[model samples]
Target: MKAVCTVLIACVTMFLVPTAVAQDARRITPEQIDRLVKPYLDAKRINAISIGVIDGDVSLTHHLGTLSRDIPNPPTDQTIYEIGSISKVFTSLLLASEIEAGNLKLTSTVGELLPDVSKANPALNSVQLVQLATHTSGLPRMPANLDLSNVTDPYATYSRESLHTYLSSIDPAAKPGEKSEYSNLAVGLLGDVLAMRSGDDYDVLIRRVIAEPLGMTDTGAMLDPSCLSDSQKSRLAPPHDANLDANYNWHFASLAGAGSVFSTTSDMLRFAAASLDPPDNDLGKAMRLSQQKHAAPIGSGVAMGLGWHFARDKQTLWHNGQTGGYHTMLMVNPKLNAAVVVLCNTAMGDVDALAGQFIQTIAGMNVEPKSFDEALTVPAETVARLAGQYEIAPGAVLTVRADQSQLFAQLTGQPEVQIFAISETKWKYRVVEATIEFELPDSGPASSLTLFQSGMKVPGKRK
Candidate 1:
């Protein structure tokens, strides 16, 4: 039910490599996702998840649950939800579109696209456009100078000049396409350069090139959805977090291309339709090119095209997104002209696993409905005993709290999150892919606790 959670990594929402098992799946309906997702909505774990399924010539959509816990109204196809990094797919398509129009090429270096930045930072000169698209660019996940104080609205203050300053400050990370890293900054810079070259706003470019031609009027670069027309603002579903707390809607100042598209399932299904069978237009040609594998990204076993991640089966191209408040997943199979997209208004641990399970069920595979949370029942006394504060580092404490029915953990300077019990002393986080194990002694409160995440273990002593 939950996978890993990342900060500012709405994988291009959490762009971990997709491991969805591909099989001879039978025809799946839009209702399949609906049935599978009711529990989360019923429990108020998620506000709503708008779903769209495309199987061959048939396509359908469903908006499950209500718009929010307080709002009893269900979301409509026109309900706006942030697609997160799925905007990267559209950004890559912009690159493809530019290439198709003879305005750019994969081999075009960053230096060529933005000579001023490249001149200041020669290392960036060798970074080819394709590397940026495939995330082979040597850029770190984000700029080192990024203001951490505003994690929820990270890109709000990042400007073109900010990117320029960072580019000038650093040396090249590697030969273009020499490394495998999932970088929001790399793709953000790519969009900046593309916009600089085209002399248009990133949003305007996407609307001109992708949305207008495809008739996806409901989709566009994410802005303050509330600032738009009154009608659209009302249509925008409010965002929530895993705690069901009110969450912020992310805005982009310079990284809209990285993760800044507000769209609906119906519009996304249209995008999927185009991906399954590209039209004869120039944009269509670019779409065709984007779906092909262009690089073997370095860090993981994931294969990548322009902005798409190739699943292990190498047949399904998919991407998932998680911002502070919203989570999104998009899967497309061009060969079968089939696809499924799930977009939610609240943050969950892993919408990818949820969607992946739905994919398995559609294969006519028997996958019993199971909860992706702490399932082992522990006595209330054990739960109460575990509640305490542990010191991980100077000024960094892990606080564990428990109500009679549920357990929660909060790190220093971070929001409190619910933790589910998997064993007598082990608990896992549903927000991100991490876990904590209590270092219990023979008796008394647990001696210590260890945080496990991303292959690292940090020990925390009783504070």
Candidate 2:
């Protein structure tokens, strides 16, 4: 189930809204925001959702649902929520700022910053600062030695010592700048290295460089109780899981640079606004540099900037993040000078879809309701016959089981979700837009299945 909760950082551009329509598009009314978000929140059982829209000089925010089912507290623009990997953009901004100050260079190697790391893995000697920011450092998504003691707060105990130990033994899967692989380890190490060069801890450095300059008072790696007033603290939304149950907040002593920031919608929108039109200052220069495409385009028409990923086709820059109990999305269309922020208290909420719809609405694009095929009634015996384990990859298995009259698919390390049968062979998840097609042989039960989602299909063989 933990693997199921892993954030899928997919940035896709749907259809581009016309420039004329975008220019004429007015601010999104609270009523319209509710109409776009309420149905999904109700269907997913998400406790709270807050959205902020920035159209030119106007800012509009809408909040829906309570902070939690038990405590009927509505989240305001000031209510803090854990905004996971969105912190990466902040880290990249720090890198860009350092570069602007001539304190660091994009060509600076990891070996140059931390000799011990290079001594342990010479491959890291070739990993450049820009590679780390653009996710081209050849680092894995997570360290191979990451053995979590507590599932809820997985990164809480992973200290700087743990990071150094992992780096001392790990090897890169590819050459530096050879390919783009999303790596928390890479970015976290970048943050750590930047801190080393600046004589500050990751949190302190972020505040002094990005947060303070931008007037983002409520955004930080550590949200100090003293900094928040009693009312703002009361408005803080409790984290919730897919089932809307209370979930623990994540702590990342070493990996905080990767995804460990709590922020309010207003604070994040302010940051987003700064990104759209950076002021004439050192930090502003860094902001502009961060939006520059420093590397080749990653898959899905997404190009890597310093910290931001650009959707070239749609002419938008965006990033999204998910923690154990929360999901947040920030999208900015610099061309239209429009941005949308969606913050959800529940990890299961589809904030990405919500943000996409919000952007489309503000851009004056038609958004059609998504439709799914009717489920076909299959015999119990037939359903039972299809129940088996399929190998998605080495050490990864997709288990299909018949739960009474319903069929469910559970991938290894992922939560089990019921699949609706489109026919006898095709099935889809109700909550997410994904389909599974079983490959039935001529004379036996299905031996394999293909997963289709986001324009990619992956085949899995029955074990």
Candidate 3:
């Protein structure tokens, strides 16, 4: 009975509002921000919220909710949140900085870095470092050999040996630079490669070269176990589950570049600000270049930057992350000196979407991008006609149905999802971030539906 929606429909219909209208460059008023953000924070069992709204040279910061519901500890702008994959942008930038320093080259192969790189297997000795970083190396989401017993503590046991063995048998999904498929193993491996090449620790290199230079005091892989005082630990927000149980923590150190960076809203906002400005340090410019598109286009009007998702209409750059209990979002609107960073301690739904709505409101755009509900149409019979199993890719089947007044879909391997009818023909779902549109074909079939998400679309033939 529990379902996750596959696509987020807002980005497609949402248009940007010009921020040219000059307003006072003060922090966003609490009243103005509360009006826009209070709904989600209040409705969801959010543990804590830290939001930084930067406009012009001024930034308004808010610390809402509590670090723990049982205890009454309020969060401050200084409270750190584990910024997941956004760390990838930083790692990629480190690689770029190495490039600028003539210490590394983007074109260098992994084999070149570790010529004797046969840890768990032999074939891995030849993989390229760039391939792993950009995720064009045909790696899975994680190591193929990893059989995590505890889903919550999944990566706790993934070892370097096992990773090397998987790489030895690695069969690329796409060639070295064919397509963009996100791979934690790939990016993490790139981190190892960087460390191997530099003869310095990955964490130390990132800190000494990037974080310290940018004055991002709270941005790093792990907080000193000693630094977290008993009060601080007690004040730390625990991640939430649907049943309100305690969840697990994410491991980025073992898998370094993939997803392991912890940071606070203030630090992230500073990172975004520095990212928008040209790199004053060698690492900064390299970071910008890493976010620049490298391979063929993957999503609609979007391309894969070195490690981030590149979207254009107004050249908006964004990346979001979801670990077990946390959701993080960071976006930079370079055109406007404006950017939004939201960190929430909850596994509830699309926190990024919620945060983006607030950002949209702050930018004077229509905050509530509209979508359909199940009962909006009375013709379930017609919607049923559009229901059935659709095969979009090899070994992938998307099942659709019309129940009562709603149209629903479930990928063959996924649970059933109720699709919101955006229009009679177009439907949008959840964080999977795709769209399902029904169309009438003139000659082939009576009515057909096409699947569009990110940038890929496949039409369903009548079956």
Candidate 4:
């Protein structure tokens, strides 16, 4: 109901208090952060957020607001928020570790691990594992064979049979090395290949190699109720749209390299710190290489490293995540030995601006992020008329509700939050880190709405 899009403030505004033991601690002051973020959070109508920062060996955790808009659960360092595609970084590390150990090869073909894959499409057998992991393997966001009947759980319905059928008919839209396109299917398949090559399940491989060694007990693909301590499990807040009933779930598939892992701020801090400072393990150098720039001239002004994404001109290596009702951003700057983790419980609230603002403050750079009101605009009449629910498709419906003179969008099986009007016809929602815009195609569709995200847009007929 409130401003759903929050802006980022400067560091001095975030930390107003002269930090204690300022001479020793190189951390940003809490007062300065509060001065900067609190008002922004209020203005954006964010329900709950857990932020973590790492500088050298010292890490700072900050929690503000409640976990749920309805229940108001307080967030803490241990709060487990689904770090969306950030899971790819972990999966990438796993692949890198295996490659470093000679258990797997980046150039290995998927057919080597899954024999049936070659039988489906001989051409696909030549696609190297690295290309799949880097999303340059020419796979689409998802398999064309998938049926969207299970909208509530997209991946849960994609079984092995469906994957095989899709691969058997694989016809790449482009040459493998021609361009860089983000493919959830490609990376997801990479995870499965790594697991098969190592003769270990995704869950087991991660724990045996990465999680257990780093003391990241709370992070994993699936949480066992019997294994997790009450306190540890309690740290998980109810994510956006209590209707979803649980944190986002990733169905096991060959495409595991894309996104599947779940973790908390505390666990991520440990992971980020290890990434910045390689421990006495084979993965240390491998991860460093993974975070380095490996591809270029791609979308996001950067290219894929081993499994990580690197900025074009900066030492900042980062990845963002979006699942059903969760959005996450994790970044680390090798030059600064500084890492940041931004986790949110709500799906539709914009936190990217907050992340940028926080980074500027921590880096002592001055920048002003646009606020929600300034970030969005729409005609008063259209804003008023578009305040009701509309069916985007036959079985898929989205509700656009007006709250506090602001517009919010709610898709079935998702969390509800105010939407930011980025333009006259475009609305951006954070739940899936995507944008939806309406358009009237002059030649064909007189009245149609289009959804856009990550440079890809699809038209949806208004129902």
lDDT of 4 by residue, 1-463 (tens): 1111111100001111112223244456566566656764666456677788886566788888777656666688777765656767777787778778887787887777767778767777777777776767777556766654454445655666777778888888766656565666777777766676678867677777788888997877642233345775677666553223344433444444455566888898888888888787686867865776656645442467866665533566767665555656777776666778887766543565566566656666554544544455565656665555556645446667665547776654333545577776677654444677766343332255665644455455556
lDDT of each: 0.75, 0.75, 0.62, 0.62
Instruction: Rank all candidate structures by their lDDT, best first, as comma-separated numbers.
Output: 2, 1, 4, 3
- Backbone clash numbers for all candidates listed: 13, 1, 11, 25
Evaluation by TM-score, superior candidate among 1 and 4 = 1
lDDT of 3: 0.62
Cα deviation of 206 in candidate 3 (Å)? 2.5
Ranking by TM-score: 2, 1, 4, 3
lDDT by residue for model 3 (48-152), tens = 777887776777777777766565676787776666666777777777788888887778776666555545434455456666766676665566566544556
Better of 2 and 3 by TM-score: 2
- List TM-score per model, in order: 0.83, 0.86, 0.75, 0.77
Measured by TM-score, the strongest candidate is 2
Q: Between candidates 1 and 3, which one is better according to TM-score?
A: 1
